[model samples]
Target chain A: MSQFLQFLFSGLTEGAVYAMVALGFTIIYNASDVVNFAQGEFVMLGGMVTFFANAAGIPLPLAALIAILVAVVAGLALNRFAIEPARGASVVNLIIITIGASIFIKGLAQLVFDKRFHRFPAFSGDDPIRVLDATILPQSLWVLFGACAIFSGLWLFFARTLVGKAITAVAANRLAAELVGISAKRMMALSFALSAAIGAIAGILITPISPTSVEVGTLLALKGFAGAMLGGMGNPLGAVAGGLIVGIVEKMSAGYVSTNYKDAVAFIIIILTLLVLPTGLFGKARVDRV
Target chain B: MLAREEASGPAWLSVEGLASHYGRIQALRDVALTIAKGEIVSLVGANGAGKTTLLRTISGVQPASAGRIVFEGEDITTLAATARVSRGIAQVPEGRQIFGPLSVADNLRMGAYLRKDGEIAVDMDRIYALFPILAGFRARPGGSLSGGQQQMLALGRALMSRPRLLLLDEPSMGLAPVIVDQIFAAIVRLKSEGMTIFLVEQNAFAALSIADRGYALETGSVILSGNARDLLADEKVKEAYLGI
Candidate 1:
């Protein structure tokens, strides 16, 4: 029983990070219909830049803030320079652009931050907390809480605020949104910035638990994309649920089945979900009248 | 009916020799029209006759390759669609493109996104009063509404922007005659309240009946223009558009 509980705790902590990444995917995808493969790089940037800033004697909170700010600027630059120039391109072409962007960012990070893995101290101390005979890291709780806070913040923003609804209106119908005075271009840039900030928070929360290298973004992005596909592509709530499911399933499979194939589980579930339920668990099938 | 005195002033909106193309295919060719403040002008045409294309150009969604569009005596031909909207030109696009996943209330709120005043709530109440059915479905997703109700929501949404010129593209399409009557009645009420409307429609009889001045468009050009009542009685318009 304690073993099961331990696996569950670890699964949940990991799932929280994936959930944040999935959310980033969903926001950009909704705003521009582009699945930004560079999402994971924001995570790496958060951890890496914070690590360097902390090494330079800045406080942890301030370092994290700088990281977030840097990530937002990078996101804006990506939208303005890369995405905007290639507007109205085919979906496949857009996907390739993001993929190319991911590779370019990864290469740039390796050059800027070196190839070594690095981690910083946890936000709350490295002590372990026990729950029902199972021990969990304090940082894990921080990850879980951070994820919950972000989800709630996004919900409030989309549900209660006018600007947030304008973003959603653009996602729903770009032409109609423009006709009603919502600037789709501005909304796209905002989505990128917001998504990047969310991703940076995820990175800051998880780096203490899992040391991050410059190349870590590739694996994280693949897992996050799988999570997004598992949840419906554009649904924020579904992305969270999908990410949690992926994380839990991965941990459970590693514990019960085979640790060697733990990574394989996410891909398998993604494939099966796509084959059987293409619209995803929470996605509504789109219907258009001619 | 209100007097047509508003039509005698300088044009509130003017399109001079406007031309648009879909790549190599020209959708509008040197099309010209004008609307004065507080005048309900109708552009009646058959499908593929460039009515929608012209309206879209005026709204700045479709770019004009040539000529100029002037709104309120200022040349606004180079403005973006959202800028045009901010300048008091709101379009209830064809097919009622309400945000399907959003609540009807949120759809209405989206229309007032650019407004910076405190009277948005009052305007919202007015919209609710205008389309009471929408008020009842305020919490429901816009996609769930029936066709006629969606049409009302679309019109109410446009009105939420407090636009000076309302551009409606086929407000009566795909609706039952009774619902069409209800929508037209609401439009008549708006005009009586001093709203300027640029209506585009294939339903010539319904459009011309309410319009003070009407233009007949055919194959990307304005072929005829006259008083709506006179056009309604024209033999050529009756044969080609009204099918009477």
Candidate 2:
């Protein structure tokens, strides 16, 4: 029972990070029908930029803030220079563009930050707390709480705020949104910035527990995409649930089965889910009317 | 004969030598027209006659390859669609493109997106009163509403912006005669309240009956322009549009 609890705790911590990444995917995809493959790079930027800034004698909080700002600028640049120019392109062309952008960003990060895994101290401390005969890192609590807070904040933004609703209105119908004076271009930029900020928060929260490297973005992005696919695409709540499920499944498989095959678990589930339920657990099937 | 009754004020909107193209295909060709303040000016044309394209150009959705659009005596031919909307030109677009997933009340709120004043709530109440059925379905998703109700919602949404110039494109399309009557009645009410309306329709008779002035467009060119009553009685318009 203690072993199960231990795996569950680790799973939940990892799940929180995945949830944040999936959320980033959801926001950009909803706003601009484009699945941004560069989402994972924002997380890497958050961790690495903060680490390098802290090494340069900046305070931890300030470093994290600078890191988030950098990621936001990167996101805006990506949208303006890369995505916007390719507007009206086919969906496959857009996907290829994003993947190309992800590769370019990964290469840039490696050149600037070097190819070394780096870690930072936790926000609160290194204390381990006991829960039902299982020991869990205090940083795990921060990760879980951060994920919950982001989800709640996003929910309120989308539900209650005028700017948030305008973003949603653009997502629903771009032409209609423009007719009502909501600028779709501005909304697209805002979504990228918001998504980058969320991903940066995840990176900052999880870096102490899991060391980050420039190449970490590729694997993290794959797992995050899996979670988004498992949940309904474009549904924020579903993305969270999907991320948690992916994390728990991965940890449980590693704990009970051979650790060698643990990485394979997420992909296996993704394939099976796609075969059995293409729309996903919470995804609604789109109905196009004439 | 009614063409001799001069408009009481200067033209509120004027389009001159407007031409638009869809690649090599010209959608509008040298189309020119005007609307006086508080007048209901209807543009009657058949399908593919460029009525929708002209309205879209006026709203800044489609680019005009040649010619200029002036709203309120200001040259606004180069403005963006959102800018045109903010400048008080609101369009009830063809096909009633309401945000499907948003609630009816939220759809109404989106119409007032550019307004920052405190009168939003007051205007919202007025819209609800204008379309009483919408008040009952405030919580319902916009897509779930029937076609007629969605049309009403679209009109109400446009009105929520408190636009000085309302551009309506085929509001009576695909609706029952009763619902069409209701929409026309609402348009008449808005005109009485001093709104300048530019209406485009393939339903020529219904549009001309309510319009003070009317224009006949054919194959992307304005073939006839005069008083609504004169155009309604013209033998050519009768044979071509009214099936008289």
Candidate 3:
């Protein structure tokens, strides 16, 4: 039982990070029909930029803030320079463009930040919290709290605010949105910025535990995509739940089975989910309007 | 006989020598027309005609490859669609393209998205009164509405913007005759209340019967335009569009 509890806590912590990335994917995917494959790089940028900035003598908090802003600029630049220019391109073409962007960002990071892995001290002192005979890191709690706060904040934004509704509107019908004076382009930019910021926050939260290298984003992005697929692509709660399921499954497999199978868990889940529940756990049968 | 009534004074909206292309295929060619304040102007055509394309160009969704769109004398030919909405131009697109997942009330709220005034609530109430069925379905998703109700919702949505110029494209399409009458009556009522309307329809007789002026389009160009009554009685229009 204690062993199970330990794995659960570990799973939940990792799940929180994956859930954040999945949520980021959901936002960009909703606003623009394009799945931004570059989402993981935003997380890497958050960790790497903050670590280097801190090494340059900046305070940790300020470094994290600067890193977030840098990710945001990168997001906006990706939209303006790549996505907007290919405005009417097919969905497949746009996905390719995002993949290109991911590759480009990864290359740039490799050059600017070097090939070494990076980490920073946790926000709070490194201490373990015991619950039911299982010990969990204090930083895990922060990661969980940060994710819940973001999810709740976004839920309120979408349900209560006009800007939030506008995002929903754009996701529903681009032509109708434009007819009502909602700038779809601006909304797309906002989606990119918001998703990028969220990705950076997840990176900041996770770095103390996992550490980050330039290539860390590739696996993270793939796992995040798997989580989003499991959750149902467009729904928020699905993303979080899907991510948690993924992390738990991975940790459980590693504990009981082998660490060798841990990394393949997400990919296998993605494939099985696609073959079985293509619309995801939370998605509906959508009748697309032409 | 067609008597083209050229723009005599400062028109409410004017399109001069407008042309548009979808790739290499020209969809609208040298289409010049004008609408005055507080009147109904209809553009009538057959299935292959460029009526929808022209309406899209005026609404700034489809780009014009040549010519100018002047609204109250400001050249809006190159303005973005959102900017055109901000400048008091609203379009009820073909097929009553309501945001399917949005509630009926939310759909109307989308129309007033750019409004900063406190009158939004007031205007919303007025629309509910105008289309009483919508008031009952305020909490329902817009896609669940019937065809006629969706058309009413689209019109109400456009009106929520308090637009000076309303561009409607084929509102009567795919609706029952009774619903068509209700929509046309609403259009007439709006004209009586001093709204400038540019209506495009494949149902030529109904359109021209309510319009003060009419333009006949064929194969992507304006072939004849004159007083609605004259065009309604003309041999070419009657045979081609009115099915007389």
Candidate 4:
């Protein structure tokens, strides 16, 4: 029973990270129809930069803050230099641009911060809290809480705030949204900023358990994209649900199944989900008007 | 002509040589038109005759290929759509583009998004009064509304902006006759309340019935311009658009 509880807690913690990454995918996809391949770089930036900053004597929270700001600026730059100039290009071209951006960012990270793996101290103390025969790290709770808080914050931003609704409108119909007086470009920029910030938060929170490296972003981006696809590309709630599901599945496969094939399990589930529910579980099938 | 009779009525908006394009296709070709304060100016045409394009250009959704757009004597040709909305220019786009997932009330509130005044609440009540069915279905998703109700919602949204110039594109398409009458009645009410309007419609008879002035467009140019009553009576317009 304790083993089962341990697995559940660990699964949830990993899910929280995936959820944040999935959210990043959701926001960028909502603002621009392009599925940004470079989204994982934001996560890497958060973890790697925060780790180095802490090692260089900066406080943990402040380091995380600076890392998040940097990620946001980088996201904006990605949109401006990489996405905007190539606007209305073919889907294949868009995919190549984002993949190029991911590679470029990874190369830059390697130059800026050495290829050596690094870890950061958790926000709070590193004590494990025991619950009903199961033990869970305090950092796990931090990650879980952070994911929930970010989701709630995003919910309020979209439902209650004007700017958020403008983003929603743009996602729904760009031409109509423009006719109704919303700037599609500004909303696109805002999406990138929001997406990168969320990714950075995930990286900062999880770096204590899983150390950061330049190449770490590629896998996270793939997993997050898979999670977002599982949840439905544009559905925010679906992204969170998808992330948690992917995390739990991966952990179970690693525990009960072979640890080496854990990543393979995620991809298999993605393929199955795509085959069965093409629009995703939460996404409605959108029909084109003639 | 009604426009001549209403000449002393203040000039509320003007479009001078307004041109627009869709990719390589020039959809609007050097169009010039005007709407006086408290007047309804209708642009009538067939599908692809640039009726929708003209409304889109005025609202700044489609960029002007060349020439200028003036609203209340201000050159607004280069302004972004949102900027124009804040400047009191609003449009009800073709096909009644209501936010499908949003609640009816929220969709209406979105129309007044740029309004900083405290009277937004009052405007909500006014919109509700104008479309009682919408008030009743305020909590329902906008997509649940029928085609005509959606049109009403779109018009209500534009009115929420309290716009000096309201541009409507094809409000009567795909609606039942009774609903079309209801929409036309709402337009008449708006006109009676002194709102300047630029209406685009393929339903020339219905559009000309309420319009003070009319411009008949073909391909991308205005082929005829006159009082709505005269255009409704013209031989060419009768054979082509009015179905007489």
Candidate whose DockQ is highest: 2
lDDT of 2 by residue, B78-124 (tens): 99989898888899999999888888999999999998888888888
| Residue pairs with clashing backbones, model 3 | none
Lowest lDDT sum, 10 consecutive residues, model 4 chain B, at: B1-10
The Cα RMSD in angstroms, rounded to one decimal, for candidate 4 relative to the true structure is 3.1
TM-scores of the candidates in the order shown: 0.96, 0.97, 0.96, 0.95
DockQ of 4: 0.43
> Chain B, candidate 4: TM?
0.95
- Among these predictions, the greatest TM-score belongs to 2
Worst 10 residues of 4 chain A by lDDT: A281-290
> What are the per-residue Cα lDDT tens digits for candidate 1 across A1-290?
99999999999999999999999999999889999999999999999999999999999999999999988988998899899999999999998988898899889988888899899999889989989979999999999999999999999998899988889889888888989989899999999999999988999999999998888887788888888889989999999999999999889999999899988877897898889988787898764322
TM-score of chain B of 2: 0.95
Q: Which residue pairs collide, candidate 4? A: none
In model 1, the clashing pairs are none
* lDDT (10s digit) by residue, model 2, range A1-290: 99999999999899889889999999999999998888889998999999999989999999999999999999999999999999999878988898898899889998898899999999889989999889999999999999999999999999899899889999989988989889999999999999999988899899999999998887788788888889988889889999898898899999999789877877986897799977777999654232
lDDT tens string, model 3, B176-206? 9999999999999888877889999999999
Candidate 4 local lDDT, A222-285, one digit each (tens): 8888788898888999999999988888888888888999888668868988899887879886
lDDT of 3 by residue, A1-290 (tens): 99999999999999999999999999999888888889999999999999999999999999999999999999999999999999889999998999999999999999998989989999887989889789999999999999999999999988778899899899988999999999998999999999999999999999999999999888888898899999999888999999889999999999999999999999999999999999899988864342
Higher-ranked by TM-score: 1 or 4: 1
